[model samples]
Target: MGAQEDTALVRRGYEAFSAGDMDTLRELFTEDAVWHTGGTGALSGDKKGRDAILAYFGELYSRSNGSLKLTLEDVATGGRYTIGVQSGRADRDGKTLDQRTVIVFTISDDKVIEALEMAEDTAVASEFWS
Candidate 1:
């Protein structure tokens, strides 16, 4: 896909996530897609396969009592990869998680095959989610 298409796909993924449309989010991923969360916090890990990834997100939302949110700030695409900068916030256990993040996506045939998520301040994120 061209750069525009690649960025558009990533944009749709963010829109689906922000809208709480899991079905649409799943449709954007390949069947065997993988998702990784950065930091050594409660939500950090490698979730293999689309099913696992979705389940992980479900757990994240549950932990935050449905208050977790990610707002896409920017997207840049090159070759078969896209990088999305986002602002994330969540509340759980009287603690709040607010951070800038980057989600790197690998896409093939217009489907996201892999994602690696990183926080601008890993230590703060870990503390907030711990």
Candidate 2:
């Protein structure tokens, strides 16, 4: 796929994720996809396989009580890689989390095969998830 197509695919993923649409997310990812979250918290680490990635997403919703919101700021692609920037906020256990994050995604066969997420403030994010 070209850069535009790759960007579109990633945008759809952000939309699906924000809407808690697991089915769409499942379709957008490869079966052996890996999602890596950077931080030293409970929610941090590599989520291998589509199932594990979905589970991590579920945990985000559960932890925030469905209050998590992600706004896609931008998407840029080069070859088979796409970079997505987003701002997010959520409330959990009386703590409020407001952050910006960037995700580098590797696409193959029109599906996401790998993702590496970088948070604006890892310490704050870790505290919120911990």
* Clash totals in order: 0, 0
Q: Evaluate all candidate structures by whole-model CA lDDT and list the values in order.
A: 0.89, 0.94
Poorest stretch of ten by lDDT in candidate 2: 73-82
Clashing pairs in 2: none
State residue 25's C-alpha deviation in candidate 1, in Å: 0.9
lDDT of 1 at 61: 80
| lDDT score for residue 8 of model 2 | 93
How do the residues 1-130 of candidate 2 rate in per-residue lDDT, one tens digit apiece?
7898899999999999988899999999999999999999999999999999999999999999999999999998986579999999999999999999999999987999999999999889988988
The TM-score that candidate 1 achieves is 0.93
Clashes of 2: 0
For 1-130, candidate 1 gives per-residue lDDT tens digits of: 7889989999998888878899998899898999988889877888999999989878878888999999999999887679999999999888888889999999888899999999999888877766
The segments of candidate 1 whose C-alpha lies over 4 angstroms from its true place after superposition are none
